[model samples]
Each structure stands twice: as C-alpha cells, then as structure tokens.
Target: MSDASRHLDARSWKALRDKSPEEVADFSTHLSQPCEVCEAFLERSDEDDAFGVESLADEALGSMSTPREDAVGWARLRRRLWTPRRAWLAGAVAVAAAAVVAIAVLPPVASKEHEDRSWRLKGVAPMSLELSAVARLPDGTLHAVTEDDLLPPEAVVLVRYRASEVSDAMLVLESPEGPAQMLGGYTLEAGTHDLKEAGELAGVSLAGEHGPRVLVLAAWPRGPRSAAARDAALTQRLVPEEAAQARLRLRVEPGYVAP
Candidate 1:
C-alpha cells in the first residue's frame, strides 16, 4: 500500500484509491473509491498487464511488414507503460461496492421524495404559488386552511405575502357594519411582508359571534388615490372581473376564522 492510502479518512471516500497489491485479492470488499480504486488496482496487476501487452504486441507485429528502427529504449518503455486493455472487471467490482454503501447510508428515506427534502416537522407542499402566500401557526409551522381547515380561538395567525412587482397594496377585511375595513395600507415593492396579528383585521377584537370572513389583498399603481376613493373602490366586492377592468395588479383573498 502507498503511504497515502493507509492513513486516509474513511469519512471522505473520495480520497481513497486502490494502490496495494493485496487489495486486488479482495477487490470486492475493499473500501476504496470506485473510480480511483479500480484504475489503481488494474494498473498494479502484473499478470493481467503482461498478458495485455503480449496480445497488443502480437497485433502490432502482425500488422507491420517490418519492425520500425529504434536506436534508444524510449519506444520500448513507452509501449510497456501505456496500453489500452479495458479494465471492465475492476470497474464492475467498484460499482457494486458503491451501490452497497449508498444503500446502507440512505436506505430508509431513499424511496420517499418528500421526506428526503423536508424539514423535521412534516411539511405541506401547496405553497408553490406564483405570488406565494402562506399562513403560519403559533408554533411556527405553516398552517394551511380551507373551509375544512379549522383554527383555534386564540391561535395567532401570520398572513404572509411575497409581492412580484412594485405597486400599492392593502389588506382589507369586511367590518361588522358591512363596509370595507382596511387593515393595512402600504407602498410595497417586490419583496415579502409578514402580518402577524390577524383579528377582524381592523384592530377590532374578534371574540364575538362573527362568522368566517375573507380578507382581500389589493395591489394597484403607486400614484395618488384619496381615502374616499380608496374606500369607495375597496368597499365594493373585489371580484376577478372588477379587478380586471380597473387594470389592477394582484388581488389575493386569503380567508380566516374569528371563532
């Protein structure tokens, strides 16, 4: 064995290569890296190399009418050092060893695509939105709710939105008196904004007998609009058709529970 091989770290298998004569005896069980190990093993095997060389020399000699004149031993040394015999046997053994190691390390999670790339807590995969939005629970895990997804009475919801363009945005909620209640209004650009406390959304306490409600998010041009005009525009329902006519940008309606 070379001095570099014995003291190598097993943690880094890439550094391992087959260099020892004894390794060829048990090539199947060796811990050497697949690529370097097989190449090194075949290069060191004298019997296989000698047979290969003889076969190559025979083929060359048969093709030639006469041997080329060589005064020095340079051509002879070159022929001895370099020959193109395929070392498929060594490569096959190395691949088998690599497969065994991979199976041992990641056997349990290898078949599960989600488990392999997910966080410690189980994750929901529906957040692949173009305008990406999500709601987080109090425990910091993501909370995905439909009409079927229920939340606790005191569970603080975190509504997050990632804007894709520069525009003015507002998150509005339906007030108890039946007009549009603006929760937040800001000049937002292309970035993320996290709203942690979602009540009736107008700072109104939500412990009373209010049914399920939907929060509307509107994004428009960043020019001037009076409070009355903004209220007039927002007080009405922001359906898909109305938003399209106004040339409005993003209109996200993320609903929540106030029970």
Candidate 2:
C-alpha cells in the first residue's frame, strides 16, 4: 500500500474509469490503495519471510539427489517451525473468531423497516416502445413520461401502467380528431397508505390481451402532449355519449387500495 492510494477517493477512481478504455487500462496499472490492517499484516509477513525461504530450501534439500546432511538439516527446521499448536492458532485468527459464534447462532429476519413505500406497477406487462423514455425527478421522486420530440408521425403509441405512491393519479384518452380528453379518478396503494388524488394522464389506444379489443386511459407518458390535450383525450374516451361515441370508450378504475 502507498500514501497516494490512501489519498485517492472513490469518486476519483470512478472518474478515472470513465476515461477512454485505453487510458483506464493504463491508469489502473499505476493505481495504488492501502488497507491499514492488511498493510500491517503484509509488513509482518515480510519480516516472517525467513521461514518461507527456509521451508523452500528444505524442500530443495529433500530431493533424491541431495546429500544426506542437507536433507536432515532442513527436515529438522520444518518440524520446529510448523508445529500443530501454531497451525491451530493461525486457523483461529483466519476464522475471525469474534464473529464466528454470532454468525453461527443468529437467524435472518425480514422487517418492515427494510421495505420501500413507493408505488410499484406490480405485474404490468412492459411495452416494446422503440422510443421508450424514463426519468427520475429530483427530491428522490421518479417520473417516467414519454418523449416524442424526435419521433416520426408514423410512430405508434405504446401503453404501460405507471404506478407510484409519490405521485398523483392521472389518465388520458385520445379522440379521433387528435385531441386528448380526461378520464375519471383513480386510487393506488403506497405500501400501507391509500393514495386517492386527481389522476394525471396520457393517451393510450391499444388492444388488450383478449379479443374483445379494448382501449383505455393508461397511467403512462403522453409523449410531449400538453395537459389540455391529455384532459380532452380522456374526456372523449371516458365520457363519450351514445350519439357521439368515439372509436373506443374507456372506463378508468382505481386498481387497488392500500391498507
């Protein structure tokens, strides 16, 4: 271990790795790090290397071609240094004796403190969108909305179920005239908390698993559509009158309620 290694922080190491592959390869060769306990152990090992050299010398002397005096001298040293008691003491140290008993007796437990409160989509099947986008907002919150800024007009809409306790409920459905309308309210479970907020929405028009051919207001990114567009799309889809029915009608349901 070296002083330079001790002064280098984790961020600096990460930055070095972010360099060109060729640069990183070369940088790693010059990188140095120090672990105090390990360093001390290594220093002790170097001081004790005399025994290692002596053992090697003994092995050489024991070869069939060696003289009788050489073989006897080395074998005597091997017995004196590698005693059974010394071997047992080394094994105890290697096992980290203080932690062995606790590890052996303790049982693993699952606690509520380890669980997250964020809303999860549960088992919603993922969509295969070529322009799929994802983002995590500031304040430790996550927001995944669509990004159609660069998509062509020929691109098709992808449907997905976006659930999270940190956010509000929103749904949008699109009308045939390119306008988006609002769907009804929704609720979600954030761990044990019930979330019943005004739903934020985006337009979605896709066939469901069954052959019934379904369209609904999905809680997914609207891909650059404004709030009004989204609201209109939902309204047209969810509140279509009998005489003014659109291609598809939607019934928004708050999927679950948390305890």
TM-score of each model, paired residue for residue: 0.31, 0.16
Candidate 2 local lDDT, residue 71: 49
Question: Which ranges in model 1 have alpha carbons more than 4 Å from their true place?
Answer: 1-142, 146-148, 175-178, 195-209, 224-259
lDDT (Cα, tens digit) per residue for candidate 2, span 127-168: 211112111122322223232122221112222332332222
By TM-score, the best candidate is: 1
Estimate, for each residue in 1-259, the C-alpha lDDT of model 1 and write its tens digit: 3334442233222222434444333433444545565455444644333225557867998988876756346434533442111000111112111111100100012224434432211221111111222223335344343332344333323234444444444555543446544555544445554322221111112222144444455554333442333344555443221111111111122344322
Task: Show where candidate 2 strays beyond 4 Å.
Answer: 1-148, 152-156, 159-168, 173-179, 183-186, 191-203, 206-259
Global lDDT of each candidate: 0.34, 0.30
Candidate 2 whole-model C-alpha lDDT, 0 to 1: 0.30
Query: After aligning candidate 1 to the native by TM-score, how far in Å is the CA of 205 from where it should be?
Result: 7.5
- RMSD to the true structure for each prediction, in A, is 29.6, 30.3
Candidate 1: C-alpha lDDT: 0.34
For lDDT, the strongest prediction is 1
